[model samples]
Target: MSRIVVIGGTGYAGSHIAREAVSRGHEVTVISRQAPDAPLDGAQYVQGSVLDLDALGDVFDGADAVVSALSPRGDMENEVIGALRGLIKRLAGTPSRLGVVGGAGGSLVAPGGPRLFDQGFPEEYKHEAQVGIDSLELLQQTDDLEWFFIHPAEVFGPWVEGERTGRYRDGGDVLVRDADGNSTISGADFAIAVVDEIEQPKHRNDRFAVGY
Candidate 1:
């Protein structure tokens, strides 16, 4: 089993990824400021923030792969980017692969087109979502790490835990929509997609989207 470290592993997306990874028999380490209530079986928990590079650096030791599920809110004047920059630098010249859980705001609706955040997204979440978009932008510019950013569809969160059909439509630089002309997926399905990306390295140095 591969040793996987998930930064921000206590959040909505991170916790799901941790659970899915453990179910796959992979050794998982979760790094976050707080631990989850019902932690996944067969997984290690480390308390730390992604903004703290030094503290976060220790968790990466001997790790085969790392996943960033860090979502920074507020003014975007934080160290989320700084922490990722450090991760890229530390992973440089190493064999560690990176998988990022990006927000839907960064996912495009068309080829080489504007992101959903740029279009008619929610007003309340516009700022934070844009920050997420910017974070993906930073990840895109990082040539140091072998990484792929996975963006989920519009309807993803704790409310919906999709059934494990292991069936999902993947697309690059374009949104995947259902027959009703809506782009969406459950959090569980998105978790499956994230783990699939970890097992099969696709869309390296680029972003991809998933939907039901």
Candidate 2:
């Protein structure tokens, strides 16, 4: 049972990951701005924002792994990358591996081709996509820290509510799609992929995608 800390454990992706980790018998701690209306069983919920360096450091200390599922919104619109930098600094020389929930915007639409964001993605989501892109670029520049970024398919979220098949596919930067040329995965199954990676430590210091 490894000690795991999820930075935005109450959010859509974060909450699912937290639940999956708890179900796996890991010591799970979720740090969020506000408590969840209904919390997960056998998980500790800590009320705090990711922007709080001191609080984040406290929660990150002594953990086997840290999953950063933070998303950009409102006041945090431009602060995601900065917060990640701070988190990386805090984890310096620690044994904890950082796992980031990345966006498809930074992923390649085709093998060795242009990124999804470069292909003129929807303007409404451009801001968030760019943040993810920047986060990946920043991670690439860092050295000596163990980190892994997991990018889900183009169609994945709470709205999608995909069913968990307990089976999914993993890939590199190239986006994974089905035979019909569709890319999607359920939140539950995506959580499964993440927890599997956390336990097995595949794709270390690298990025990968999950889809079905």
Candidate 3:
């Protein structure tokens, strides 16, 4: 079993990914500022902030892979990008592969077209979307850091509460949509895609999307 560390593992997406990893028999550790409301089974939870490089380094040590499922919110909005940079710095020369949970805002609606953020994305979510975009851009510029950014569809979140079908469509920078022109996926299925990528290592040093 591979040793896996999931930053912000108690949050919605992070928690689901942690559970999926544990179910797969991988040794999983979750690091976050706050603990989950209900503890996850078969996964170890470490309460701490990602900003603490010393603590973050300790948890990341000797891990096979690290999944960053952190979202940009509140105080985290301005800090997520910096935290990611710090993570990359710490992971330099390490064997761990970094996996990031990205937002659709940075994804493309069409090939060679404007990013979703420039295509009339909601104003309230603009900041978070840009943060995701910036994070992807930063990763793209990093040299020799094994990484993959997983972007979800436009309609994905805890509020959506999509059903877990154990299935999803994978796409490149373009957004994936159903025949009816809808884009969505449950948190559970998204986690499935993530864990699959973690185990198989497809789309290395690139970005991809998953949706129903």
Candidate 1 clashing pairs, residues 3+ apart or interchain: none
Per-residue C-alpha lDDT of model 1 across residues 81-157, encoded as one tens digit per residue: 77777778878767788887777787877888887887889998776576667777877787767888888878777
Ranked by TM-score from best down, the candidates are 3, 2, 1
Q: Per model, state how many residue pairs clash.
A: 0, 0, 0
lDDT of each: 0.80, 0.89, 0.90
Candidate 3 residue-wise lDDT, 51-141, digit = tens = 8878654788899999998888977878999999999998978999999998988888888867888988999999889889899999999
Name the lDDT value of residue 140 in candidate 2. Answer: 83
Off by more than 4 A, model 3? none
What is the alpha-carbon lDDT for the whole of candidate 2? 0.89
| lDDT per residue as tens, model 2, 1-212 | 99999988998899989999999999999998897999999999899887787864477778999999999987888889999998888886889999999888888888896998888799998999988888888888878689999999999998999787998898688888999989898888999999999999889889998898
Judged by lDDT against the true structure, how good is candidate 1?
Answer: 0.80
Which has the higher lDDT value, candidate number 1 or candidate number 2?
2
Model 1 residue 45 lDDT score: 92
- Sort by lDDT, best first: 3, 2, 1
Candidate 2: stretches off by over 4 Å: none
